[model samples]
Target: MPESLNRELLEVSAQVRGLLQDLQNLGFDEVPLAPPTAGLPRCGTAGRADGGEPGVSCRPESLEEIRADLENSPCCDLCRERGNLVFGVGDPHARLVLIGEAPGREEDETGEPFVGEAGRLLDRILSAMGLSREEVYLCNVLKCRPPGNRDPRPEEVAACRPFLERQLAAIAPEVIVTLGKCAAQALLQETTAVGELRGHWHEYRSIPVMPTYHPAYLLRNPASKREVWEDMKGVMKRLRGGGSR
Candidate 1:
């Protein structure tokens, strides 16, 4: 056999093994193969799976639909303990989206993002940039507050990620600002420290992500506000069609 043919066969075998492994991971011991039918409608088409009556098109949900789903979701244990699910707020069509770690006590109580003292600092920062909370979309990596406002656990972040992903997809913001280490790491899928990640442009699924110090952090160390300002300037430059630093 030709060397190229042998290599292609090996690649095909690897792919097949990977598919089987994925099936196993999904709790499927075996997949029953079905013979192709001549008149069956395609999956996700406006018809039944077995080619019955026409059905509604399987399109992506709107932002409202996504929010409604999150609101009604009972999958997370955090939901049982949370006062409110702090789903994001702001313009659904905003060009920029601000992401944070999770809800704080005030946020959970008020059911709004950035409503605490840290939120006040965030407002000041936004005002300095000539923006407002209503002008940009704001959300968090986790919808529920952690016990005693501790950092989000890996399991919690994993469980909550789907909601954040759907929300981001629905909004499709041009630029994303990830506040604090946890939010930045979650969005970038990197473990780099926030101090190192800040003031640089990172990509999350093709969207530009600007990592910056969280307002809460800034409250603790007021000197770092200057650095956060510099990061915000980069975000502003991108929004205004200017080149990033």
Candidate 2:
């Protein structure tokens, strides 16, 4: 065989093996012989299976370790003095975890993530996906609101990373859906455009991460709702059938 053809064959073989491994991990008896090669990326484990970042770090050995980090870390003053921490809400055993950028005007007032207009819309979206507020964990990259609803700064994200890490440690969700560009970037530690990142499954701290349009953005750009719906459908399929690699 030609060298180039042999290389191509090797690559394809690796991909097939990877897909099979992913399906097996998802508890599926069998997977498609070929890759989807379409709409969304295949579902599987994170590229970084160790649950640690290249430069960034995470230390979550036990629930007590997570709790001590939260209590001792002087990360976000807002979380410290706020009416409520709004760390997160949902069933700890939830299969889906929704993470947004930060609290908004109404969310800040209520000290609960995803309770604003965007949140109400998110509830509807969850319903469309056959999930309810009680079934999924809801949180944000930052527990507190940024001034004037502006994007969260890098420093702010770093400050709150420990808290988010601890929450994920405690919940140990199967999948994480990042709501917007900011949340996606913070979780993935990348500056990639949201459009380029959506419709694919990326990994963050060893969890399958799905980037979707934020409800707030969907409220402004209704045209994009169709795309979001498609992504949600993929999520629903994964939830229903366990998952496919």
Per-residue alpha-carbon lDDT of model 2 for 1-245, expressed as tens digits?
99999999999999999998998999999655753334432211222213434433323244444445565665766656555455677787788889999887777787678997888899999998877999998989887777677888888899887667767766778788899998888889889988989998888777788899899999999899999988887777776775743
- Estimate the TM-score for candidate 1: 0.76
Off by over 4 Å in 2: 1-72, 80-83, 242-245
CA lDDT of each candidate? 0.87, 0.77
Clashes of each: 0, 0
Name the candidate that leads on lDDT. 1
TM-score of each: 0.76, 0.69
Clashing pairs in 1: none
The window of 10 residues in a row where model 1 has the poorest summed lDDT is 41-50
Tens-digit per-residue lDDT, 13-100, candidate 1: 9999999999999999999986655444333211233233456233344567666767787657888899988888999989999999
